[model samples]
Target: MKRIYTIALLLASLTRVVAQEAEQTVSSKINQVAVFLQGAQITRHASVPLKAGVSILTLTGIAPAVQQQSIQVDGPASVKILSVSFRINYMEEHKKPEKIKLLDAERKRLTTLITQEKSIQEVYLEEENILKTNKSIGGTEKGVEVAELKAAMDYFRQRLLDIKQQLMQSERTIRSYQEELAKVDAQLTELRAIKGQPSGEIVVKVSTKAATTAELDVNYLVNEARWFPSYDIRAKNVKAPVGITYKANVSQQSGEDWENVTLTISSANPSEQGVRPIIKPWIVGYNNALSRRTVSGSMMTVTAGNEVHGKVMDDEGQPIPGVNVVVKGTSVGTVTDVNGNYSVPLTSDAEAVVFSFIGYNAIEKRLDKGSEINVQLAPDVTALNEVVTVGYATSGDDDSDDKSRIYGSSAQKMKREITATEVIRQTNVEFKLDEPFSIKSDGAVRATDMVEYELPAIYEYYCVPKLEEDAFLTAKIMDWDQYNFLEGEASLFFEGKYIGKSILDTRNTADTLVVSLGRDSNVLVKREKKKEYSSRQFVGSNQKVALAYEISIRNKKGLPISIVVEDQIPISNDKEITVDKLEDSHGEYDHNTGTLTWKKEIASGKTELITLKYAVRYPKGNRMLLE
Candidate 1:
């Protein structure tokens, strides 16, 4: 009976102990609640609020042994048993450890190779220097034995070459090592990513510990959808100048949809005040994974003007296609057609049309009342002259020789004058020798050598004058036609000082002169063209007739002064033609009416007219007269 009582009491005690153990709750507190289920340590707010009844907690980077163990949570509620599970990132653990070891070994090997390569390169440089020093010493000392010195030089040279070769090999090895190291690093990074995190398993635990229970809810955060505006504007060649239409396209990635979005287009640089918007915003949505929207309006009128036509050509008289023709102040522009012709409307009152092409100087012309315009672009001779001529010539027999003479003389004179100015002028002239001139016995030349010469000369003239008082005038013959019509430039001087320069081109019937004057300069006297006689007219016996012409003068500065007029004509036949009505006053002549007149002092910027009239008759049978 004593043994039974003892056994019963022991059993009761053991049962009580077991019950107490069961009632005791185990709980844990994670400093960082959110942990990756793989190799990385992380902190994520619990999606579901932790409660006494049930909760899920995912843990990461936990030891494999600990992952399989049960986790208990003790809270201020009834004891509950929560199912638990384990997650192991086996691939991450296996790959990262192996890659780390390999990368460390490779890095060490590359470092050693680089260091050795540098040392070898230094050795080569030192050997080369030694060879150079030996050669220098051998050159300075004449008493040294030639053979010994030669042997020494040969030894050093060979040693230097060997060192260089070794250095090269070392450099190659180092480069190869570096490449291997890079590949190893990439492999290691990939391995680390693969071994990083396991995307499986969720753990839940419940404990009888004293912790408050709360209702749990889950929510997710995502990026919101928004609209971004973008546009591209361009203009085409048209008679009516059109303003740019700004178009906007919207794109979104997030699944949320947008509505009632307004887009506004405003010019950052408005040409005029109160310009209205052209593009209005429209609704758009994503289609087939692409978000886009296009908005267009009526053609905005930025500028409106009459249509004008023009031809573009280079200095060599060749038409240039695809030249850009732009209205100066606005974006309205067009390129020349295939025929080097462009027609564009004017954009602004102050704007000038500019014709620009590569390899040619740009030409700009201001819009006026005229509809027909011509633009001649100069060549960029400042860069290079592609064609040049060098030859000899004499005075004109039929004015054909005069062209070559002009080019040669101009080249020589330009070279001399270039010293006085900073400008360097280069002239390139080309003459085709398709027809050669010959001296015939009878002097009856073939076709009188009436050659048609097309002069395509390139002139690169730039000048930078030093003194403030010094000035220069240049007039280029922009156009020419007849052979007898002479076009030349001349500078007029007063009291050893240049006043102005004039470009004169005259036909037998009419004369046109354009004059440009320097500051504070005045023209007092008139210059005129000589009268031409009729080829069919017959002169009287011993007849000395003079035909006179007159020029009008203008002053642009101070009050004009009285100036004398002088005339001289180099007649082909001096005896047959004589001066009759020699005008001793200011110049005045009329080729059509055959009249001459004269006037007195001209005011500043005012014209003074002069004229002279004379009758001229050709001597009979004086057909061989030279002019």
Candidate 2:
């Protein structure tokens, strides 16, 4: 018996060894194959051989979204996969088996209890129906024979109460079973998820056309595992219309699932297009201010074929009349009339022209090709140096050698010499009257009997600057009243042309005369007054009279000047009259015919006052008067 027992033990030990060897062979083959998780392209090779009893695998960088049983070995394996265990944390994998085992036991316990609760509820319903039937029989018998009925009622009541209590208890047990069943279901659902294998490396490709640098951050999760891809793309000496792409290969475990994958690429140059080019004008002048001139007036006209025309004014901006204008060098020039305009011809050879007037500075302008030219002339304070107006003519001492001399008598001088009486006679008188008279002892005279006379006269004279003639003189006296005395009749002549005119008129009683000179000039004036009267004494008695006279001279000049006045008075008395206040006064006086003589040396361009007053008495009845 001992021998047979030993042999049987040997056979049993041999069978156990064969089973262990088969399990090892299956695990080796399974471990040799790569495992891949759902949603991940990378495959993971086993670090350690998987045995036939193994139900879980730990992986790095694996996706969490992998489904249970989704993990598969790509190569042949001996054992089929029955279940998969998944865990977010690697350490949780170690406890997965125990948790799954406890869940299965709880599920079995709940299933058994649920069946027992359902059977007890059925029994409670049957007892409730029996108690109802007993109550109905008792009510039908009324008070007849209740001895055994009480016993039956008591037993039925007890059984009914017990059954109701059991039913209530069953309901509570069923509720607790349902709660346990829910917990088990949740555990089963969690355990069904497949754990992904680790993806050791991955490959990433980036493409761009910008001439700049780029950087990328890629984050991926596989089976609740996370991985980050960090890289930078740099471009050097890159030009436009050029593109490049970066490719990299990274390795990772195969069973990892990709989740929450974020790939971001940032570049240094953000623009997709190139830049373009720009262009600006030239300016000139000081302070951007322009110099301008204007020429204007009535009698003058300014015309420039290709030149600008404008108005001319004085320093105070007042228009000046009769201005002389000329070019700078050449003799191309013209004079401004009363309107202050001059159309000085431009010279083709001249580069610039000068504009000059009597009291203004000469202005020069460069000849521009434009049709307009404007210039401004400043005031010339030294205008007295050229063509200054003297007593009766203009002196050319101040002019340049090439300039023509301005020779003309001033209107003031000629108007002053011609009296109002002469002008009236020239305008109105028909026949000339000539009578000689002499100074008397008392400076009084009587004229012979003559007819009454009334007549008007007119006179005019003109002086102009000599341009061609050397010297000339002319005179004319008209008849009748056709030529009457009026203002602005006396004209001045220098050389031969008229420069200006003077107006002379008599006062209210045809006694006092006033003279108005047009232009500025020196003047010399003369005036005469004469009167005649006659009377016969009774019988042969002699007649005489007294005469009184006053003479005054007013000089109008800045400096001392000279003035001479001569008077011829007719005298009838033989006795010589004595003159008074002669030397001490303005001039010497004559008392022979009551005639007074005044001579004075006045100042230059100034008015001097000369006055003479005297009285004379003649024989009674002898008439004495002035004519």
Candidate with top TM-score is 1
Q: Residue 464 in model 1: shift from native, Å?
A: 65
Give the count of colliding residue pairs in each prediction.
24, 100
lDDT of 1 by residue, 312-410 (tens): 866766555556565564434455554567776443242467776534577887665366677888764442212122121211212223242122123
- Writing each residue's lDDT as its tens digit, candidate 2 over 210-299 gives 222222222222222111111111111111010111111112221322222221111111111223325433355666534333443322
lDDT of 1: 0.38
Q: Which stretches of candidate 2 lie over 4 Å from their true place?
A: 1-98, 134-143, 195-223, 226-627
Give, for candidate 2, the lowest lDDT window spanning 10 residues: 235-244
Residue 466, candidate 1: C-alpha displacement in angstroms: 67
RMSD of each: 34.3, 58.2
Maximum-lDDT candidate:
1
